[model samples]
Target chain A: MENLLGIAIGAILINNIVLTKFLGLCPFFGVSTRLKNATTMGLAVTFVMTASSILTWLVYEYLLVPLHIQYMRIVVFILVIASFVQLTEMFIKASSPTLHRSLGIYLPLITTNCAILGVTLMNTVVEGYSLIAATVNGVATGVGFILALVLMAGLRERLELADPPQAFQGLPLAFISAALLALAFQGFSGMIL
Target chain B: MKFQEFTKGIIKNNAVFALALGLCPTLAITTSVENALGMSLAFAFVLISSNLIISALKRFIPQEVRIPCFIVIIASLVTAIDLFIHGYSPTLYEHLGIFLPLIVVNCIILGRAEAFASKHSVSDTFLDAAGVSVGFALAIISVSAIRELLGSGTIVIFGHEVVPAFTSSPAVVMLLPPGAFLTIGILLALLKRAKVI
Candidate 1:
């Protein structure tokens, strides 16, 4: 339906989880040093976000609502997200050793990533999206994160050669680049379906 | 020695400026000074309490399950603070939104639990957490102040105009996502240039 498409587009561009929502920023700045690492982190986060969104939505609707402990959402949603991150780590380790190694450093970091948990909570608590809608939002948000990170990676890859002031050499320069990128992305706001 | 541990977190090992560990809340709720203060209070509460409990129970938590345990403690604390703040100030609660609860996943809290609290004694952990919390508070407050002043042309705290508008045409971007990055990015750079970081 058009509604779903709107949600997907809205998440990916208009409300980009990374550039706008300020979620998963740790990896956004940390792992974005290289295209390979950035893409891998993006895919991993996308997987976890989609899986956790579905799971958390179901839990919120089925368990939390029925139990009348909706206030326990923070505690409940985080446990669910942490468990899923663990499962993804284990699965990746077993299925693809290379990816596991490539993503190994970031896997643990993802557990603490506010982006994954932030989206899940947003889907269930804030936006109140249905399961299908929540899943789409999650996937789209992940895609958004990937888009931002990959773009940043490409930019930073070239930034390595550019000579800036002594103070603006490393993260300072990266943050400035992100500012411009975010300003560019800010133009995407307020688009209608 | 204990005083040194607390003092170091302010500058030498600042959670936000040096480590860049607490970027989520630093950017999300820092649109205004009040929001920043509310968030800092909530963050300090969860971090300090979690550090105290985790340090006390670190030995029994078992190495394998310590992370999950730290998470549970921190999440429970966040939920409590979230509810309490909502009841106390519906306005602040609404402004904070999901970022309030997202404190459970803030890397600064978890990173400290793993690196410092789990290793040190309870008192040491408490001082360390307090220091890091203060450092984080200072960083967020400064960023929020900069954003509000430049973006809004004034500084208002708790409904009072503490600082009047200086510019008729403020750089509104300072109040947006880019502003957060710009503020912190330049802050870090200036600190580096002055050897303050």
Candidate 2:
């Protein structure tokens, strides 16, 4: 239990997906313009990430290890993610028209978001997480992504009105802000249980 | 028809500077000159081979299945390159680590396939791939050069320390993840000011 708490806290604060790992940057810049869309996109990614982590964990431990085809994990994980995104898109379109409309644009992009793949890959590659640990990391990473994105969106919403030079108007300003935010997150790196 | 398609990717639509795609690898692995070179060479090989194969077979592949097809081709090439790097240059392979295999999903490769390769002729597609790969390599090298020099107080390339250590205390912040953002952020502003980007 203590180990799990450490993993969760470490993932959420220390190894944040967007701020630290630099994954899912496309949406970090694109969909972060509005709070509504930011929340919707965050929730969408959270669902898919958690679900895919569970499924991929099963495949990795049962199928890949037993088959001795670990090199194929990349190909396998991507296919699973792509298909899962497709299925989720379909389900959203069929089930919740309102939520679907809000999240429609981000759904397809999530296929290439890299954060999803990064989480799954991190499970197998970096952390070497077990099945439960992978699920926890996946969900926690999703939370971390949400935390970063929401904070960015909130700040960007205010930054639009701030006075800035012409050259540093748009994406450049965002990068600077992200740099500061990343630096702030560094303070959490030393946290210990 | 040929040169235009190829040349466009180099300057007008340079993947990193203009398109803003593939920022992850562009920022992450570019902490050192050696990592930058290794990554660029790996990406160049994969981008060229994948684009060529995709263009050659674009006619047979259905539009709906194009993405999966492109991904499979890219993943296979990345795996092959990953294995080759591991066998030949264990040091470079170790330094690159996950980013090496993560190249499979680097949007630049797939973006080129979707945007140019699927529509252009085989020769044209090859040129586009080469141009974009070169452009990406240039961007990574330049960023890594700045970061490595300031962050570490020395310049090292391909496992050889080329420059003497400059300062006892470098700005260690420039070596961390935040430093990547700061470096690129400032570079982008400077480039825009000079109208280079």
Candidate 3:
């Protein structure tokens, strides 16, 4: 239990997927302008990451490792993620039209989002976490991503009222803000587990 | 062999700066010039090969499953490159870490395949891929050069000190995540001011 807590805290605070690891940056900048959209995108990513982590863990432990075809993980993991995203899109479209409408294009975009693949690959290959640990880490990473996205969205919304220089209007300003946020997140590195 | 196809990706539609397609690897593996060079080489290999294959087989791949087909091709290429790097250059492979495999998800490769390769001829797609890869290489190497110089006070490439240390103490922040963002942000602002990007 203590180990699980450490993993969760480490993933959320220390090794944040977006701020630290630099995964899933497209959605970080693209869908972060609005708080609602950021939240929706975050939830969608969390769902996919968690689901794919477990599924990939199973495949890695049971199928790939036994067959000695671990080199095929990149192709296998991505195909799984693409299929999973497709299934989720279909389910959302059928079950919840409003949520589907809100998600819109971002739903499909999650398939290409590197964060989902990063977490799955990291959990299995890098960290070598077990099935349950992988799931926990995936959820924690998603929450960390949400935390960063929400914070950035709030700052961007506030920036709308302030005037910046002509050269630093849109993306340049956002990059600067992200730099500061990244600086702040760095302070969490020394925290004791 | 249109000249415009080769020239456009360098400045007009740079994958990194203008289009902002593959920021993940752009920020992640660009800690040193050596890593940046290795990454650019690998990326160029995958991009050019995948573009060639996709453009050649564009007529056969169904429209509905084109994305998946493109992905499978890109992923297989990445895996081959990953194994080759691991076998040949263990140190660089270790330095690159997961970003090497993460190349499969780099939007630049897939974006090019879907947008240009699917529509253009084989030779045109080849030039397009080469141009975009060059653009990406320039962007990442520039970023990595600035980061390494300011962060570590030296520029080392392939076990050689290209730039001697200017100061004993450098701003270590430039080596961290914030440094990557700050460098890219300031670079973008400068490019805008000069109207270069």
Candidate 4:
């Protein structure tokens, strides 16, 4: 239980998927243009990250490791993520069209988001997390990603209103803002589990 | 044909600055010049080989199943690279670790395979892949140089000290994750100010 809490906190704050680990950055900048879209993308990612981590963990421990073909993880993991996205699309279309439309294109983009793959890989390879531990870490990391995205979206909205020099207008300015935010988050690095 | 392939990737359609693909390594590995060079070479090996094979076998692969096909070929190449790196350069292999295999999912390789290689000739595809890889290497290495010097107060490459240490305790954040973000963020702004990117 203590280990579980530590992993969750560490994943969310100490080793944040976006701000700290540098995982899932594409969506951090891409989908963060609007608050609503950011929330929807966050929820969608949370769902996928949790599901895929569990799936990958079970496969790695039972199937890949036992078979002595750990090299196949990249192939297997990608195939699983691609197919899982397709499956989620079908399920959402059938079960919740409104939610599906809300998510729209971001749902497909989730397939490429490195956070999901990063968590799964970190769970199996880096931390040697068990199936349950991987699931917890996965969900926590997703929540962390969502937190970073929301924070970034809020700041970006404000930046759009603020005056800036010509050179820092678009992506460049966005990056500068991220730099400041990252500096602030560095304070959390010293937190004790 | 030669210039078309080379120029497309270097500037106009440069993978990092222009295309904005593959930001993970662009941020993570750029913390050190050594890691940056290692990653770029690793990525180049995977990208060029995958492009050639995928381009050569373009006809046999079905459109409906093309993504999966490209992934398998790319994954095999990544696995091969992963093993070779582990065997030859254990230190680099340790530093690169997950990022190495994660190359299989890097949108750049699959993006090029789907967008360029699937339709272009094998030779042109090779050039395109090489150009993009070099362009990416340039970006990563440059960022790493700035971060290593600033974040660590010294620049060391492959266990050889290139410069004397200026301070005992460097900022150290530059070696951390957020520092990666901050460094790239500022660097991008500087480039924009110079109108280079």
Give the top-scoring candidate (lDDT). Answer: 3
Q: Quote the lDDT for A63 in model 4.
A: 95
Q: Please, what are the lDDT tens digits per residue for candidate 3 over residues B23-114?
A: 99889888899999999999999999999999999999999999999999999999999999999999989989999999999989999999
Worst lDDT run of 10 residues, candidate 3 chain B, spans B11-20
lDDT of 2 by residue, B1-197 (tens): 56777777776778887778888887788889999999999999999999999999989999999999998889889889988999999989988877887887788888989988898889988888999999999888888999999999999775588887989999888888889998888888888888877
**Tens-digit lDDT track for model 4 on B84-186?**
9999999999988678888877889889999999999999999899999988888888889888998989899988988778999998888877677767767
Docking class of 4: medium
DockQ for candidate 1: 0.88
Worst 10 residues of 1 chain B by lDDT: B1-10
- Candidate 2: tens digits of C-alpha lDDT, residues A1-193: 3378888888899988888887888788878888878888898899999998998888888999899999898889988999999998899899999978888888888888888888898888677888888888888988998999899999999999999998898888888899999999999988996
For all predicted structures, in order, the TM-scores are 0.98, 0.97, 0.99, 0.96
DockQ of each: 0.88, 0.72, 0.88, 0.68
Question: Which stretches in model 3 have alpha-carbon errors above 4 Å?
Answer: none
Stretches of candidate 4 off by over 4 Å are none
Q: Which scores higher on lDDT, 1 or 4?
A: 1
Quote the positional error of residue B111 for candidate 1 in Å: 0.6
- C-alpha RMSD (angstroms) for model 2: 1.4
lDDT of 1 at A53: 92
